[model samples]
Target: MTANKIIFYPDNKEINVDQGTGILEAAIMAGVHINSPCGGKGVCGKCKVRIKQGRVETKTVGLLTKDEIDNGFVLACGSISLTDVEIDIPTSSSISREQILTQEAKVEHMEGIISRLDAGDSEGKEVFIHTPLVRKLHLTIPLPSLDDHTSDLERVYREINKLTGLEDISTKLSTIRLIPEILRDNNWQVTAIIGDGKLLSLEAGNTSHRNFGLAIDVGTTTVVVSLIDLNTGMIIDTEASYNRQAHYGADVITRIIFSRNKQGLDKLHQLIIETINDLILALINGHQIQQNDITAVTCAGNTTMLHLLLSITPSHIRLEPYIPVVNGMPLINADETGIKINPHGLVACLPHVASFVGADITSGVLASGMYQSDEVSMLIDIGTNGEIVIGNKDWLVCCASSAGPAFEGGGIKAGIRAMEGAIQRVEIDPMDYTVRYNTISEVKPIGVCGSGLIDTLTEMLRARIIDQSGNINESIPSKRIRETENGLEFVLVWKEDSGTLLDIVITQSDISNLIFSKGAIYTACVVLAGKIGFDINDIERIYIAGGFGNYLNIEKSIMIGLLPDIDRDRYKFIGNSSLTGARFCLLSDKAMKIAEEIASKMTYIELSADVSYMYEYTGALFLPHTDMGRFPSVQL
Candidate 1:
């Protein structure tokens, strides 16, 4: 195959690829990101690019309109370049980092946890202990004499033992070689960097106050990093961005399939590392901190994400008997994992519960303090995979359901992620069937996001524009309700009101997809509760974790059967608990221990093996539920 030159406009990036290569692959090589939720299988029409001057062969148009095809628009994943090409990627098809939710939600309960630690109460102080994963201790060595001469290593260990009251301590040969010079040059004064029962480095003078660490949340869609002052247990700065590995897939299962390709696992691993490193660079640069000062990093993510972060093969996770490579990871050196921090810095990950229910849920359980409570509670993290945990200090159970990417804007027409031009709220007038909506960043609407989709479904139900089965009411007297070649569709935004200058409609098929997604989540929660001899209503409190939960409307979510129809007051949102838990672990070793306990104590229930799952899932496919008695609050 001969190489052909390809140029992408606006970005002005160029790359050469073998002839007949997919345009999507060329864009990836050229450092351009085009949204492909279907992972280049050509099912999603999102990877649209306009050909300015090129010879290309498109295998299938898929979702592209005839008008779009006539205008030289082609699906980047489906098109193959026969000769040199010049393609332009539209803003609607490009991924942006401006709106990735990096900040955790503000909740009184979460603040109370921090306040208790800050106040230094007896129990709180003892539990947290301010024992960071890495610590810098300033020590003064006794001056050596002819009568009491000892090796520099022994002298240093003797002082450390006396200070920490610990008998066992260790160090590397590299640090041992520098002890004589580091001790004598500083006049018997040094700051020792210790972690995991070993000395990492020794610095001259009192450098204890400069110690820093990172708390990382390696989410499937986004990556967040928080730089913290390990000495004082304070966050210095935070940064986040979209995971660049999304070029391969939108969800873990798809990524696992992609991993079977040649060098696919390595490519995914490198992409995630690049994303984290970029965020690390931004955080350190903004705070004027040195890379070497970051003595440790604590991470929280799903099983597949953690596996990919450490470059481990996760092929078995999606297969039968679905077992992960390691549910509980051991402490590793930062350099070994290619994380850009101190070379001797330690890296730690929160433990996982099962193949699908992973550290993110364990971290959530820890951050929510549910495992320590006497009353039963439920924790839910909604994404492509919906993880549910229910328990108290006495018992715990968890399950994960493959809810698909409908909530994150996949497999739906006119759907997108939570970005700057996305519609995130919707309302409809029951009298005239008119629609009102709000876009993120106050920009013109491009597409509906998860929250907005939920709002739309609820509003449609309330206004009777859609039936209980999510069927569009074509009999309604409104222009917004019309039939397309695909199916009956409801226009949320007219072409004139849209940033893309195209009508954004929610089709009947999109409604069914969302119903299936919501049904899977709701059914999983119910089944998990049933396995423990409980009901959904028996959960005294429900803690919602994740970025999606931060903006989600409880009323709308319940109305759509995505959540149980419990009392609204029983619901509490603990945003980004995974990151919060990582931060806690970075600041206190006790927190890390508790997180491991949470992972170990959890009893995982595999839903696939349960006979009642499909039967119960069928009942949840309708609005609210097929059994109206389950949703007493929803009167419609």
Candidate 2:
């Protein structure tokens, strides 16, 4: 095979490759990331490097115009080095490793016993305290006779309204027709189960023995629930399951686009509702509790997700300006939202600030104590969306970008949820290219989850299988290198060693999508922080919030520049902050006020409007970044 000596100039690193090896691949052999917004398909000509001294034979130039060619700029992926050549690789063309989302290095949960005692102390050290949400009750009343002169329905309505603060109660026609029979049979002593600002069921006499409430965090990829004992203001149980909406589309935007088709909205609605109801059934059945006992609910989710849950049309959100029908939705009944709780139970969704910065961020801010902190801090809820809250006591700012479902195992080929067989972490030998991976249960790996993906990206860089610029070296001696239809691929595992007989690898396309996903998040954080007249490092603490953060590897994440290279001690992890925040609000009215303030004070930055975002994104598409100064700890 004819070899070409491609000396990446300035750095002066030289590598010899066969005729077909890409210039981007040659650059990686020297350690660098070329910017490719369109995944190096030559569609985005951003990955231009100057061929300073050699004949470079070229094939296609999808985005390169005549002006670019005249300036000696060649798309690294499009043109091939024809001979020994010196190339001045511009720093602007480099891609850096993005900060991966991780669980906080430190856990900051309330002291279980202390929190319990504080909750009880205010109410005379009593075990029971009143939550703001209303409850259901069945009352027995005195019978009205002909001499008393009050109509049966009027008497019942007047007494019930006076006792419960509800107005002339409503019921189904069947219930209303049977009202006289029930009053006569029970001698005016009957039970009423209040739901959705109205009466749901009527029985005979006092029955408040089993009151339940459900607080759920509806993630684009997963749904979690915490069952609350409304009678005692205590969390009784929790349940989690995959969101059924994955079948439609992996990300919110994709799902929204899918929802525009015929019956897509209805299917999307039923899928999530079914997931929620299954969890409720799990909690109820596990404790031998009745479904009728659940008289109230609280839900927290991103704006697009909220729209889906409410069955609201989400087509407009995917369009320009990204407008949504409502941010802070009004409270409704369980029946209205298809929740299988008590029929008339109130389903209160946390209020949202904007289309991007929804209640999930508000709930996360509440849980992270962002509104109460005196020291400057950053709260990042790394989920399907990158919801960031930066502030302390004086001021607050928020922004959310669609990070795509890459982290949650959506876009990648061998991706799966962090389930039993999912790979959670990876460590690769630099000298030998051997690999060691940890699974969710240390079993045979099925697919790589978010944590595993972070570890893999870092390991690949450190091991030299890929350069800092995220390009694979097809010239490496290891059999892991293979020619795929998409491009060159590096196998993480061979088919014979696997559980499902599949060769697991990260493709060039995967790397491209990941770059954009993490780049968008990192650049958004940087841009938003810059707009606030401060840098990300100026904050005293960085709070990583969300379900993904609970199990991610912080060190590996930092090594990849997916997270800022700060003192590990400065980061704190709060698991499922959205749910925790809702729980706090459920336990104390004070939390609601705090949540409201966090939402009100937050200055949301729309990154889409800022053209500089792409510029920042271009700089971040490297191993640790073009400006290695930012990540002092990440060294080659």
Against the unseen true structure, what C-alpha lDDT does each candidate score? Answer: 0.87, 0.72
lDDT per residue as tens, model 2, 486-570 = 6887788776776434567788777776766777677777887888888878878888888778776788777766777888888
Per-residue lDDT tens digits of candidate 1, residues 474-536?
A: 999999999877889998988888887678889999999999999999999999999989989
Residue 205 Cα positional deviation in candidate 2, in Å, after optimal superposition: 2.4
Candidate with maximal lDDT: 1
Candidate 2 global lDDT: 0.72
| Clash numbers, per candidate | 0, 19
Per-residue lDDT, model 1, residue 636, is 93
